[model samples]
Target: MKTYLAHGTRFEDTALCRFLNDYGHADLDALHASAREEPTRFWAEVEDAVGLTWHRRYHTVCDLSHGPEWPRWFVGGELDLFENLVGRRARATPEQPALIWEGDDGDLRRFSWRELDDAARRLTTALARLGVCPGERIAMYLPMVPETAVVFLAAARLGAIVLPLFSGYGADAVASRLIDSEAMVMVCADGYLRRGKRVDMLGEARSAAAAAPALAHLLVVPRLGTPWAPQASGQWREWDYRSLVAACDPDTGPTIHGTATPLMILYTSGTTGRPKGVVHTHAGFPLKAAQDLLMAFDLNPGDRLAWITDMGWMMGPWLVFGGLLRGATLVFFEGTPDHPTPDRIWQLVGRHRLTHLGLSPTLARLLMAAGDAGLPQPGQLDSLRVFGSTGEPWNDAPWHWLFESVGQGRCPIINYSGGTEIGGGILGCFPGLAQKPCGFAGPIPGMQADVVDAEGTSLLDQDGDEVGELVLRAPWPGMAHGFWRDAARYLDTYWSRFPGLWVHGDWARVDADGHWFIQGRSDDTLKIAGKRVGPAEYESALVAHPLVAEAVAIGVPHPVKGEVATCFVTLADPAAADSADWHAHETALIAHVAGLLGKPLAPARVHRVSALPRTRNGKILRRLVRAVWLGADPGDLGSLENPSALDALRDYRDSLEAVV
Candidate 1:
């Protein structure tokens, strides 16, 4: 395996190195082992290192009386996330930039620490006047703008739970979360600019408010500068966000609550069931996010951080809470990455002089496919010190392109992998460690992570070629307390697979050098002729062919082989679809995969397509791809970014059936 050695100078001054020196540890591996063996002591150190403010001290760092599946953290402590993230920072560094926003139309806005806190105070007073009390859920469906941050801080200050909904969601998707959470208030925008066009969000928010009987108020931000009035009906009322804030006095103080109090109910949609609301607390999610930022990513105060994400995604809250708690300036973009121009993202990085930037592998693929002209010019990304990746497994070509072309081989790609339920990363690459292409250094501290087979036996000590399920032996502070109001489902989803083990449904493997790599979702694993193979393996092979830009491999039922791989791919040069040699291109791609693996494991079919179904965060829905191909129900598509892509897949399926 190819490896990228970390520069010794780079590790000399990183946060991880400083931590190791302070604790008298020689390296990260030693600290990790110590953390796993004594989690309570490790977490206490982390809490103090991250500088989390507490109104009342906790007696215990972690309480496991309810078992690992339902562990309580920071027991008996009283704190408020708003106070730590905003109020404290404002008091200490009032002149520092706290938040910066850019609109698709080239409009820019910046807020200092003091200014952000003052705005949050006004909004908190407004929410109080609306009768929003502690524990009440406030659903935010607004775009990535300054108001989104204000609303989050405002709700958090009042001890109210914040539910961030995707700005791209339709009325039905918005209403489902509102009704499920029984949210008393919904915040949205009048409209926002995307691709230089205005998207009317108020209409959808209004429709959702009407559908949710429990919703009592609709607070709208005038993002488009268009005249709008509230259309009140029954107990539900609409109010202008600016007007409401202006009418109230600033609520200068924060409402303190128990450390384990629910600060957010982040709902993650499943393949076949209702969206699972993952509960995160004031001390739980924020602390984990800050810890990861400080230790894993080496984020520091005054550093500018930006991630291409929507407010509804976990990274959105992760960025807001973690960046602020670390005293970093946040950069929010109110449109797609490629909007207005292909180099829009690179322009943002250069314009803001961002120190750390996070993006998905899919986005990297998209940008890489755009070729040399589409990438940053010389000296454009000189300010970038580190690159962060998550959301999906990375292919070698894109990963290499990002590492070599974009970063110029100077920075490390901090590959982070975990789920919404994990609150943060289970495994991540540290700035202080050597990295391999598409590989993780190992589990984050406090996460007792291991690779196991069907019997729940460790695979790390076995052959280096084996791939197995990723499981956590002990609970970490960042784990979801439980699914909101769905205790049975939560237990069954993660805990039922192995006794006392948290089965994180992803296939993983470790190389000879102890570098970890995630294949793909274990549920998406394909069994061909009794041989278990990850879709990433096949997808990786297909994309290696020069013609293919992106690919998704899924298992198709076969009477003979039990299951066979069927592939769908989008070409690097889209115009190649209409070429007369398209059939030859597909045949060559099939042979390439067979050459990489064996003939027996080769794909049964390869179809060229324009796009695949993906979530807002760029995770390709392989289950939906297989389901649509089989004319099966593509369940729970609320988070789907492009429904039209599914329609294209369905049309291709119908054409195949007609030909048969």
Candidate 2:
């Protein structure tokens, strides 16, 4: 593997170094060991370092008497996350930029810390007047706009649990989450621009509100400036967002709550049933996000941070709370990265002078296919100091392009890996660490992560090459409290597999250099000819080919090998698919993969398509692809970004069956 070293500053100049010095630790490894040995003391120091204010101090840092599965953090403390992220920041730095939004058509909106606080306060008053109380769920189904951030802040201030739905969701998808959470108020938009087209969000919101009986009020933001009125629906009432805020007072203070009080209920999709609501508390998610940003990513006050994401994704809230808590300016874009032109993302980075940028490996692969002509010229991305990656494991080509080409070999690519239930990240690359391409330095401090085999034995202690399940031996602040109203399901999902460990369903390995790499989801692992392999291994090999833009490898049932790898790919050039020699090209691609990995590990077949099924966050849904290929019922596709891709796959399967 190749390693990249940061060329900008010495290790002593980083925030991680300063934190280590303050904690009387010599290096990153030492701090991590100390954090594992003394979690309570480490977390107390972290709270102080991040400047988390408590209205009423806690008597204990953590209470794990209930075991690691249901540990309580910050017992007896009282503080509103809104107060720490916005109210205090507004009082301290009133004129500093808190949020910056850019529309698809190049419109701009900026809000200072004080301005954001006032806006959120007014909205909070409006919600209270509408009879929204603490513990009541408030659903937000809006695009990535200034109002989206305001809704999150207002809900937090009003002590209402936030339920964020994806902006691209259809009426049915939106209704499912609303019904599950029983949200009383839903905030949406009139419409939004995507790829120079208008998306009718109001129609979907109205349909969803009617379907969900629990929804009472619908607040709509005029994103496209369309004049609209409330429809005559006895099921719910509608209010213009701006008018409601104008009619309310901004003096209503934040509602205080205990540390473990529920702040948000984020729903994540499963393979076969309804989406599971991952519960996060007041002091859990925010503290972990801030710690990761401050200590791992080296994000500092006044530095601009931008992650291409939707308001519904975890990174969306992660960016808002974490960036604000760290006093960093956040840049939110209202459209896709490659809109109108391929250089749009690079242009945004240049325009906002973003210091820290986060994106998915799929998005990186998309941009990489655009070539250097579509990228920024010299000095365009000079302001960038660090790059963050998550959502999915990365292939070498795209990872290298992001590091060497975009970052100019100066910034370190912080490969962060974690799920919604984990709050932030289990593993990440710190600033002072030498990073290999597409590899993490190790587990985040205090995570107590290890790679274990089926019987829960450490794989790191064994010899030769080995991969095993990523497990956590202890609890951290960011672990989800439990699935909403489904404690049994939560326990069965994470803890049932291992007696006392939180089994994160990812296949991971630690290299000889002590670098960690996540292969792929454990459930997605393929067993072929008595050997287990990760789908990423085949997809990475296929993507390494010059013609392949994106790839997904799935295991299909086979009589001989029990399962065989079937690959689906999109071409870098769409015109290539229309060529008369397309079959020959596919054959050559299969040969390429067979040469890369030995013949036994090669894919059985390669199919070309225009696009692949992905979520709004740009993670390819391999299970959905496999289901569509096998003619199985694809369960819970609410989070899928492009449903049309599934239709294309179905058509290919139909064609193959007809030939048979």
TM per model?
Answer: 0.98, 0.98
Summarize candidate 2's per-residue lDDT along 464-562 as a digit string, tens digits.
Answer: 558899999999888899999999999999999879999999999999888998989998998876777888888889889988999999999998778
What lDDT tens digits, residue by residue, belong to model 1 across residues 583-615? 887788888999998998889899998899898
Q: In order, what lDDT does every prediction score?
A: 0.88, 0.89
- In terms of lDDT, the poorest run of 10 residues in model 1 is 2-11
Highest lDDT, which number? 2
Runs of candidate 1 with Cα error greater than 4 angstroms are 6-9, 577-580
Worst 10 residues of 2 by lDDT: 251-260
